[model samples]
Target: MSSELAEIEGQISDIFRALSNGFQKMDKIKDLNRRSRQLEDLTDKMRESKRLIKEFDREIKESQYKFDSETTKLLNEKKQSMIKELNSYVALKKRYASNIDNKRVDLFEGPGDGYAEENVMLASTMTNEQLMGHGNHLMDETDQAIDRATKVVHETIDVGTETAASLKAQTDQMSRIVNELDSIHFSIKKASQLVKEIGRQVATDRCIMALLVLIVIGVIAVIIVKIVNPNNKDIRDIPGLAPPAQSRRLLWHQD
Candidate 1:
C-alpha cells in the first residue's frame, strides 16, 4: 500500500507537471496571438497612414486646380510633410522587425543549454530508475518543439510572401493618388477578414472542447449506472430485510 501510494504520488506529480507545461504552452500561444494582434493593428495603422498620405496628395491636386503657379509650392510643402510622416512610420516598423529578429535568432542559437538545464532540475526530483524510464519522453518533447518551430517558420514565411505580393501589386499598379487610396481600403478590408478568420478558429476550438466534456460526462454516467450503483445496492438494503444476495442471484440465474 505504501508503494502504491508512492507510485500514485509520483503519478500525481507527473500530472501536475504536465498541467504546468500545458499552461506554459497556453501562455506561449497567447503571446503569439497577442503578437499577431499587434501585427494586425500595425497593418491597420499602416493602411490608415497610407490613406492619409494619399489624401494629402488629393489636397495637392485641389490646390493645383485653384492656384496653378502657387500649386507647385503648396504641393512641395504638403509632400514634404507626408514624406516625413512616412519615414517615421517606416522607422517604427524597423524597430518591430528588429525585435522579431532577435527572438528568432535566440531561438535558433539555443539559449544557455536549454533542455539540459531543464533536465538537471527535473533529475533532482526523481530516483535514478524513474529518471531512466522517463528521460526518453522528456527528450521527445524537444523534438516536438523543433517540429512546432519548423511549422511556425513555414507559416511566417507564407505571411511574409503574401504581404510582399500585396504590397507589390498595390505599388506597381496603383500609382495615382485615388488608386493608392483604393488599395489602402482594400487592405483594411482584408484585415477585417483575417480577424473574422481568427474568431472562427477560436469558436471552433471552444465547440470541440464542449463536445469532449459532454462525451466524458456521458461515459461517467454510464459507468456509474452499470458498475458503481449495483455495488452500492447491497449497502442500501435494510438490515431487517433478508439480504438481497440470494434473491438477486436466484432471479438472475433461474432458467
Candidate 2:
C-alpha cells in the first residue's frame, strides 16, 4: 500500500510538473502575442510615415509647378510691355522727325531775319540730337533688360532641374523604405505563423498531458480499491497461502 501510495504520489508530481510546463508555455505564448502586436503597431507607423512622405512629395511638385507658371507669366508680361514701349518710342520719333522737317522748310521759305532762321535751325538740330541720344539710351536699357530676363529664365530652369533631381532622390529613398517595409511585413508574418504553430503544439501537448493524468488517476483509483476491498473474490491469491482444512469432531463411545 505504501508502495502504491508512493507511485501515485510520483504521478501527481509528474502532473504538477506538466502543469508548470504548460504555464511556462502559456507565458511564452503571451509574450509572442505581445510582440506581434508591437510589430503591427510599428508597421502602422511605418506606413504613416510613408504616406506623409508621399504627401510632402506631392506638395513639393505642386509648389514647383506654381513657381514655374508664375515666373513664366511674369516674364511674358514684361517682354510684351517692353515690346509695346519700344514700338511707341519708334512712332513718336517718326512724328517728331516729320515735324522738324516741316519747321525747317518754313524757316527757309517764310520772311525771317537770317539770325532768327539760324537760331531756329540750330534749335531743331539740338532737339534731334537729344532725341537720338535718348533713343540710344532706350535701346541700351532694353538690351540690358532682355539680357537680365534671359539670365533669370536660365537660372529658373537650373533651379527646376535641381529640384527634379532632389525629387528623384526622395523617390528613391521612398522606394527603399517600401522595400524595407516589405521585408518587415514578411518577417512579421513568419513570426505570427511560428507563434501559431507553437500554440498548436502546446495544445497538442496539453491534450496528451491531460490524457496521461487521467490514466494515472485511473490507475491510482484501481490500486486504492484493491487495497480497501480485501474480500474481493476476484483478487488473485498470494503465493504460499494455503486453504483452511475442515475440522473433524472426535466423539467418545459409551460402554
Candidate 3:
C-alpha cells in the first residue's frame, strides 16, 4: 500500500507538472491572442491613415491643377498686353514717319517764306520727341510684362514642386506603416505557433503519464489478486476468478 501510494503520488506529481506546462501553454496562447488583437488594431489605424493620405493626395493634385491654370492665364494675359503695346508702338511710328514726309513735301513745293521751313523743322522735332517717348514707354511696358510673366511661371513651378514633395512624403509614410503592420502580423503568427507547439508537448506528456498510472494500477490489482489465494484452482477456474466460498454461496442461492 505504501508503495502504491508512493507510485500514485509520483504519478500525481507528474500530472501536475504536465498541467502546469499546459497552463503555461495556455498563457502563451492568451498572449498570442492579445498580440493578434493589437496587430489588428494597428492595421486598422494604418488603413485609416492611408485613407486620409489618399484624400490629401487628391487635394494636392487639385491645388496643383488650379495653380497651373491660374498661372497660365496670368502669363497669357501679360503676353497679350505686351503684344497690344507692341502693335500700338508700330502704328505710332508709321504715322510719325508719314507726317514728316508730308511736311517736307509742303516745305519744298508750297510758296512761303523761309519761316515755313523753320515751322516744318519744329513740327518734325516734336514728332520725333513723341515717337521717342512712345518707344521708351513701349520698352518699359514690355519689360514689366516679361517680369510679371516670369514671376508667375516661377510661382507656378514652386507650387508644383511643393505638391510633389507632399505626395512623395505621404507615399513614404504609408509604405512605412504597411511595413510595420506586416512585422506585427508576423510576430503574431510566430507566437501562435509557439503556443500550439507547447500545448502539443504538454498533451503528449499528460497522455504518457496517464498510461503509466493505468499500467501501475493494473499491476497492483494483479498482485493483490494473486496474493489473496495462491492455490485456489476452483476460484481461478471461474470466468473472472471468483473465490471458492463466494461461488458456492452464489450456486446455492440460485438453486
Candidate 4:
C-alpha cells in the first residue's frame, strides 16, 4: 500500500512540473507576440515617414518647375514690350531728323534765274552814258542795284543763320530726348527685373504655403484615423495621438 501511495505522489509531482513548464512557454509566446506587434508598428511608422518624404519631394519639384515656367514667360513678355517701345522711339527720331533736313535744304537754296535776266536787260538798255551827262544817272542806277543785291545777300545770310540756329536747337532737343529715352529704358529694365524678383519670391512663398497646408492636412488625417480606429494604435499616437513632432519640424524646415 505504501508503494502505491509513493508512486501516486511521484506522478502528481511530474504532472505539476509539466504544467509549470507549459505555463512558462505560454508566457514566452505572449511576450514574443507583443514584441512582434511593436516591430510591426515601428515598420508601419517608418513606411508612413517614407511616403510623406516622397510626397514632399514631389511637391517641391512641381513647385520649382512651375516657378521656372512662369519666370520664363514673364521675361519673354517684358523683352518683347521693351523691344517694341524702343523701335517706336527710333522711328520717331528718324522721321523728325528727315523733316528737319528737308526744311533746311529748302530754306538755304539759291535764288531763281529771273533776277539775272532783268539785270542783263537793264545793262543792255543803258547808253554808253546816253550822253556822258547821263553817266551819273546810270551810275546811280548801278549803285541802287548793288545796294539791292547786298540787301538780298544780307537777308539770305540772316535767314540761313536763323535756320542753322533752329536746326541746332532741334538737334539739341533730340539729343535730350534720346537721353531721356535711354533713362526710361533703363528704368523699365530695372522695373522688369524687380517685378521678376517679386514674382519669384511670391512663387516661393506660395510653394511654402502649399507645403505647409499639405503637412497640416496630413496631420489632421492622422488624427482622424487614430480617432476613428481605436484598435489601430500606431506609434504616431504617442504625442497625444497627433502626427510626429519631428515631421512637423521637418515640414517647417522645408518651408
Which residue ranges in model 4 land beyond 4 Å of their true spot? 1-133, 226-255
Q: What is the C-alpha lDDT profile of model 2 across 1-255, one tens digit per residue?
A: 234333433443443344334333433543444534543443343344334334433444444544577654553454344345334433543454465456567667765454676766765777777868867986998899899999999999999999999999999999999999999999999999999999999999999999999999999999998887766753224434433333112211211
Q: What is the TM-score of each candidate against the true structure?
A: 0.29, 0.36, 0.34, 0.37
lDDT of 3: 0.61
How high is the CA lDDT of each candidate model?
0.65, 0.58, 0.61, 0.60
Candidates 1 and 4: which is better by lDDT?
1
Candidate of highest TM-score: 4
Give the clashing pairs for model 4. none
226: Cα error in model 2, Å: 5.8
In candidate 1, stretches whose alpha carbon ends up further than 4 angstroms from where it belongs are: 1-33, 112-255
- What residue pairs clash in candidate 3, if any at all? none
Range of the 10 consecutive residues with the lowest summed lDDT in candidate 3: 1-10
lDDT score for residue 19 of model 4: 34
Name the better of 2 and 4 by TM-score: 4
lDDT (Cα, tens digit) per residue for candidate 1, span 1-255:
224333433443443344334333433543544654564555555565565556555655554655567656755675576557556555665665566667767778785456787878878999989987797776898899999999999999999999999999888776776787999999999999999999999999999999999999999999877775565555326356554777768766873
Clash pairs of candidate 1? none
lDDT of 3 by residue, 147-175 (tens): 99999999999999999999999999999
**Better candidate by lDDT, 2 or 4:** 4
Give the local distance difference test score of model 2: 0.58
Report the lDDT tens digits of candidate 4 across residue range 106-198. 556645343678766766887776545466876898899899999999999999999999999999999999999999999999999999999
